[model samples]
Target: MKLLFFVPLLVVALVASTFAQQASWRPVDTKILSPWAAEIDPANPHPEYPRPQMTREDWVNLNGLWNYALAPKGAGMPEAYAGEILVPFAIESALSGVGKTVGKDQELWYFREIEIDRSLRREKLLLHFGAVDWEAEVFVNGQSVGTHQGGYDPFYFDISEALQSGKTQSLAIRVWDPTDEGPQPRGKQVNEPRGIWYTPVTGIWQTVWLEAVPEHHIRSLKNTPDFDNKQIRVQADVAGATAGQRLRIRLLADGTPVGEQLVANQEEAVFMLDAPQVWSPENPFLYDLEVALMDGKKVVDQVNGYTALRKISTARDANGIQRMLLNNEFVFQYGPLDQGWWPDGLYTAPTEEALLFDIEKTLDMGFNMIRKHVKVEPARWYYHCDRMGVLVWQDMPSGDMGNRWESRPGVIGKGTEKDRTPESEAIFRKEWKAIMDANYNFPSIVVWVPFNEAWGQFDTEEIVEWTVDYDPSRLVNGASGGNYTLKGQIMDMHNYPDPVMPDPQIWGDQQVIVLGEYGGLGLPVDGHTWQEKDNWGYQSFKNETELQERYSRLIQDLKPLIPKGLSAAIYTQTTDVEVEVNGLMTYDREVIKFDPAFLRNKHQELYTIKIPMK
Candidate 1:
């Protein structure tokens, strides 16, 4: 496996006075608020450490209130900030306190006071942003630090040189996101949101922090688990690496070292575990890892992380239909289409607690998997899934829609693929690869979905081939609910209201057959909706009993297809998003339309349905 990555800029220790300064900032009023909305403290928004897979002891959380201004596109640093917009929350979101839209015509400008503690001044200071939509240019003490593009990937800059005479330095940022106007991967965001489309999220929507690291440190870590062979592959990208430097790795089970190895810098280390414990949804297990950068016997730098052993592939059954296998066995994956959106925060969740709520509720409903629909979540989201045992089908956030797709689900690529401009195609490829590279280590992500519903889908075969070549450990869903092509390991089709499967006889031989989406039974709870007048679902019901009956019927309609070779099924959604009420839960996450116990009971049966074996 290749670690196509960059120097990961991360966060620093949140000292006392920095958080206490943000007490006055507050979220603006919103139509619907999640239960965790009230708990948001502007002084310490998303206080949890941003990166979980790789652990660092020291970092500053730059998430509190920041001075902001919306200036004309191609504008320079603002002379005066309009107001304080909470860091990590998009300007369009209520949590930002400035619920205004910034488009192609304008840039979102942010300025804040950053104080690097006197103790950490000697080391290299790295600035990290969890994600900034579209494009971002940063400055320190009025000097240009760096610029980054692509909306959904983590990026950073080394600001050690930009520091001034004192600990207090001025940080300024200029961001431009065109949303629907440009060909960038904006996912469901639209200039004007309605139905499935959502509000634009301009500027930073994830964590912003700073870290101090030694000259020689791990830039990034890549671990690949081969469950079938009972071995794991590990490699590290090191900063300030020299020819004589070495890498030491210790793999532990229950904190007890099982294997240790030393390899030259940039060399892959393969550690074979004696009877490795397989990680699965039933028993999600993880091995602790300690890695060190060494110059001979002297330890230069080290970090703590973890890895899981799991394999995702396709296998044949008795009838010769390919099944989606986990560790060489069919698990019959089933889950909901999880669009990670919040009414108050839009692109950013109100809090880390709120961020984990959807995942926790997903498991409560007995969902074995979740199709993270056209949105790349924070690293912690995938980290939570890895620990809690849920399979993730990660999507490349869709953009440049209006491309024509095949008219019928049975048809495979009757329409021409979209012809994107050179700039547009490059953005898609760069962001997709970066999204994969940044998230390659999480074992919970079993599949990589490049296109959703044919939105921004170009060079289908070539792109799918690149994805497979990039990471062969996970299965690839060529185009979920999009124009099907004779590529990738899985063929996915979308249907509404009723659970219908593409005839296994037609698609099973070439790819693993699955229903990407079905069963959208909507019932809008009165006060818990984004809007009261125009609530919608594929199949709408008036009452709880009616919704339950319709949903149960849909599940019953899907069970028989599993035995007939439907390898997986994803329901329409996890929660109501904006005006789309076709979710098991309401948009605010205040109400579960149906009892979780009842839904879990019906879903468990789908996993038990056995297919014919040869």
Candidate 2:
């Protein structure tokens, strides 16, 4: 009788388990994945620390699989979920294990379980999200905590009070992204993926995690290296400083003490160094830092960080024309027009190694700078550039691109600017400021590009003036390949198939002339393209030999512009994206069409010519 009773119960249990698996599981779609994607453990995705500038030893990564459902945009909450989708990967991406699209009228929902240690519960619990697309509303144990409304910047919430009883608690997130239908800064994302426009990234496209901190902690840090003075200015933003709390900062160079500073109540201090190592592409050096909040001598909170000492400015070259100077020297900046995207993960790379791959490959291609076009990458991407010694020209992603763009070379043309709605303008300004503040610590970024090719360009004069005044430490390219704005330092132009400059005879006297984009030579290899048909490039080639020969000729043609007051040049791209097959490598990153040695030898000859002052 006992055996018979247990047998039926076991059968029921087995059937239930099978049904659950069938409802909540799906295989990853057929797409090109990096080697790192194969190594991803769904139990713990993105295990590495997300914030390189401010890091704590005690934290938990909340990536991995979560219960997910797609519902109407106005839907409050679904009592039941549809399936499971991978966190940190967009719902529309193949790596999410659910290659489904959520349109403008729908909202994506996520549910997961979280646990907190009883001992650590005494301290304040904070939830941190590296990023979420468009807008996100977070909840803890059935209670709403907060809502964040930015697709690119990081935001957090204090969910300590919302935690229910027991070690385990419920966590939920709701996300909505309108892609191109909205007037927000959506970058290149579009509901209908086509040439140059990519599939929309919706919900948690970056690492999500938790941290336990004391009542008083270091909320943020700003480290600015004054190269001329041999000192580093430090500012700490304390979250909960009591009456007698203080802040201390210690600077180190490879474990050796270089300088230290302490301030009472006030959060500003300067550390004068003995011998500062100048950071550059050839010899990239970083100084280690330890920041602490203390009650007299008792340590309250501590964090680890690092910074680089370098300078980027604009000055007249040997000629009377304006030129960009790096570390007080005139070196022509050459790099690819990098559009940050992936086949499997969309906006998110499969892994940290995959994130570093492009920078490493760019360095291998003998390029010192990268014009990061129309999109902001994860913080780790810039961290790699800082450590690897590659400079960056970061662009504010374009949206509401209704402006009439005029690309008439040799003619100074100011394109008709877009008239953004009050709400849309507010959204752009808020997000742009947040993006700048979040990335100000990284030393690799030398230029901040406000507009690109007149896409969503507006209020050129005022916006350019505001950008220049906001961050005088870095050079501002107000409009790259866009209108001929009389603000900012560089006059940039974009030309296809061949190298071209911004008419040195016109804008050379006041601003630096540069070819912001050019040379999109394309050769699509079979089995490596995103689609079988309709794949295109700015200039198509029949074979590897033709592509290589044409590429070398373009570089040879580019060198003569340097003597004519051209300060820099950017090639079309680092990898193929979507239907655009104008990359040095394939979309899958599986093939490099040209020989590296041949390309490097050709690029080296461009730098050998000396620039003499007039």
Best by TM-score: 1
Estimated TM-score for each candidate: 0.95, 0.94
- Tens-digit per-residue lDDT, 1-614, candidate 2: 00112233443355345435554443365455544555556777778899998899878899989999999998798899988888899999887988899978999999999788876577788999998998999999989999988898998998889987899999999998888999889899998888888889999999999989887888998888788788887788889788788888888898998888887645667887777888898888999889989898999999999887888887776667888888878878999999889888889888887888888888877888999998888898988999999989999988988888788654544779999999888998988998899999999999999999989999988888898898877888888888879798888888887887777766888888888888888888766688887899999998888898899789888888888888889999999998889988887676777666676787777677677644
lDDT of 1 by residue, 181-207 (tens): 999999999999987898899999999
- How many pairs of residues collide in model 2? 2
RMSD of each: 6.5, 7.9
Backbone clashes per model, in order? 7, 2
TM-score of candidate 2 relative to the true fold:
0.94
